[model samples]
Target chain A: MEAQTIVQPEKKKSNQDVIIIKHLNKSFGSNKVLVDFNINLEKDENLVVMGKSGSGKSVLIKCIIGLLEPDSGTIEIFGRNIPDLDRNELDEIRAKVGFLFQGNALYDSMTVRQNLEFPLRRHWMNVNQPEVNKLVQEALDDVGLKHTINMMPAELSGGMRKRIALARTLILKPEIILYDEPTTGLDPGTAKEIIELIVAIQKKYRSSSLIISHDMNCVRLAADRVVMLIDGRCYAEGTYDSLKKSGDPKIKDLIE
Target chain B: MALPVKTTDFLQETGGISVFTGRFFKEAFKPRYEISEFLRQCFVIGYRSLPLIGLTGFIMGLVLTMQLRPSLIEYGVESQLPAMVGIAIVREIGPVITALIFAGKIGSSIGAELGSMKVTEQIDAMEVSGTNPFKYLVVTRVAASTLMLPILVMISDAISLFGSYIGVNINGITSFPLFYTQVFNNLGFSDVLPAFVKSFFFGFAVGIISCYKGFYSNKGTEGVGQSANSSVVISSITIFVIDLIAVQITNVLNLN
Candidate 1:
């Protein structure tokens, strides 16, 4: 079945753009992952980057978070160029940015409470034990898994582990959150719950989020704007409804 | 000009390890020492390996004494058993054996651990949380192993001497004080210092190489296994090479 065609509206520019990338290029030897990819995430907006497996969605997110360096171009986060920042400066930028891994990379050796407390202890070195405990409790409470505080990550189920990882990310109260395939491996029901939680958390925290996912449901439910990454570039971008009505075969391929 | 694939891979691996070691040195001395984490690693990498190191040391001492008794009896030097065993264990055998055992237990463990973290993006998550994963994970572990191996060697030497005493009593009687006196009398500063110094290098080789392999590991679960396996192999070989160099250096210095 062919979807009806529609013109996507021009995106309104905002002075509150929290993250801006321009002509970014990243390659692993001869394999170019991101080529001249450009995107901007505005304040308190949920921007989803959708791409197929091996299409560099993770790499893009990694580059933004300083996990992977770009071959060229600028990643301007909060008026600072990421590649140009020194170690200490980069760390300062990172403190304000939270990331959720597809695998829920909770430290296997740490208890849930410890996991939540890691960032707080690291970034807020002067925070007292009582404050640390309270922050840990609050973060876990945000994820609705306060009961799992003392349990090691191994003891938690897959969904619970994801919640704990999210809680850890939340504990920092970061200004920006980058989610790499947030719902990649969960069952449909669990995936829906996570999506809902992400939406709720975004609303509560009002933090800008750059989410990388190929999950259409995740894009539909969680994305305020969606960028389609293809051929190592920003293939297309629009609201989910606008893109769903796009006649471009590439856009149709993803929406369907 | 193109190098053979294997040659290129070997060159890449070597270069990567060297760079990683250099980075460890750089990050290690920087501010924000992970003292508590380093202590935890010391307990894990040093204290936890005790039973295995102890068992092996005991067996090595007992077996060495028994083996030397037959050979020494022919030369009528059987009474010098304690001194010979002591010198052998303290000067060369103790450090090398404990290090090899450490490589087996700790090297593979660090490699698998960091490999899994890389794959799961926990390491990335740490960076996004404003923590230097290298400082937090690598520096702490490498520093712990480097500092702890010498201590482990010392304890292993003591245990081996005790085992040697038991071996001495198996055939004939020797008072504990006399046996220890004979052992200590034969041991000089040269024997102890050189042996002690080399253990740090051994630990460093294991820690740095394993971390290098795991930190850059790819290909998911298989990569984790490969990282673990390669860590042990490379660390064992490096230990022998280092021992050879230490022996040569000691000889040059006339420490023998």
Candidate 2:
């Protein structure tokens, strides 16, 4: 297929919109992964993007976070396109965004406290040790993992590791958080607890979140709005209940 | 005619590593350097590799001295053993052997560590936490390796000389002062400087190539293993290539 390229106009700062992805297209060789994909994440919104494996959900999130460069598109955060920003500008934008990976992505060599303290030290260089300790304690307390501060990631159970990862992300006091399969490998009980924790954090922080997940339980529990990704585009967008009630075979196929 | 697939792959990989090295240079000089992380990496890459490097150096020196003893005795040059062994170790064998061992241990570890971090999305998490993953991870590691290798080579050379001293005393008694005096008297500035200078390149090769392999790692757990394996292979090869270049440069400059 011939590729079409279009430059998007710069977006204005919007109090409601935390992130905006417009005409996002990413291809590896001839295999197009995201074609004209668009989405908006509103402030204080828990927006879940759901898709089957290899459906480009992860790519979309990566694009938003500037981890992956889209072939032609604009990912707007704070009125700036992510792909167009310089390192300093991008870093500034990133200070307000947090990301959680499927594998928990804890710094394996570091203790839990160090992991949580990493972002603070990186982003806020002037932060004192006492403040760092307090923030780390608070972040761990948010995830109910404060007791595991001195323990290495290798010693933590999968659930505990996930919690630590969450705490690390939360330590930055981000305005937006992105989660990629946060409960993919956990037991049902653990998954439920993680989903509940995600919900609680969203409410407590009032931060917008973009969660990429396929777990129906996660969708039901954590997503206030759901975007169905299919064939490199957003096939449908609605509240979780509305999408669940749809009679469309594609939607049914997904929920089932 | 189309090139062989392997040749094309090799070319592509070389180009990628060059670009990665270029990026390392660009990010390395930017502000907000990761000082603590760099120091941590130095400790991990330098101090931690000491025991293995020391053991290898000792064995290399002893083996070389013992092997050369018979030849020297036959030539009626047995008394010159200390000078010959010192020159050989300082000029070539010490740097090359220590670098090879470094490639095996540090290269593989850095590759696997960063590769697993990439696959698990920790690197992405770092980026999202307002940190430059390249600066915080790659630049620190590359710089640490580049800086620490020379010190390591110096230490290894000293240890190797001690080993040679011990080997000298094994059958015939050579006073410690006499052995060290002979070693020092025979070694010139040219001999020591080139080898010392080349070690930085060896360390850079190991650092950059391994980080390149790991930073772009894909596929999953299997990819992590491949990154670790190929990092050592490529870094070992690159170390030899750099050594050859250093030798040529030294020769042209009449430094050898």
**Which candidate leads the pack in DockQ?**
1
What's the lDDT for residue A130 in model 2? Answer: 92
For model 1, how does the per-residue alpha-carbon lDDT over A98-199 read when each residue is reduced to its tens digit? 888889988887888888888887788899999999888888889899888889988988889888889888888999998989888899999999999999
Give the per-residue Cα lDDT of candidate 2 at A85: 92
Estimate every model's Cα lDDT from 0 to 1.
Answer: 0.90, 0.89
Clashing pairs in 1: none
**Runs of candidate 2 exceeding 4 Å displacement:** A1-15
Tens-digit lDDT track for model 1 on B1-256? 9999999999998898888999999999988888888999999999999999999999999999988999999999998999999999999899999999999999999999999999977887777767788999999999999999999999999999999999999999999999999999999999999999999999999999988888988999999999999999999999999999999999999999
Predicted candidate 1, C-alpha RMSD: 2.9
Docking class of 1: medium
* Candidate 2 per-residue C-alpha lDDT over B67-180 given as tens digits, one digit per residue, 9 for 90 to 100: 999999999999999999999999999999999999999999999999999998788778777777898899999999999999999999999999999999998999999999
Clash number for every model? Answer: 0, 0
CAPRI-style quality class for the chain A–B interface of candidate 2: medium
True contacts kept of each: 0.85, 0.88
Which residue ranges in model 1 land beyond 4 Å of their true spot?
A1-15, B1-8
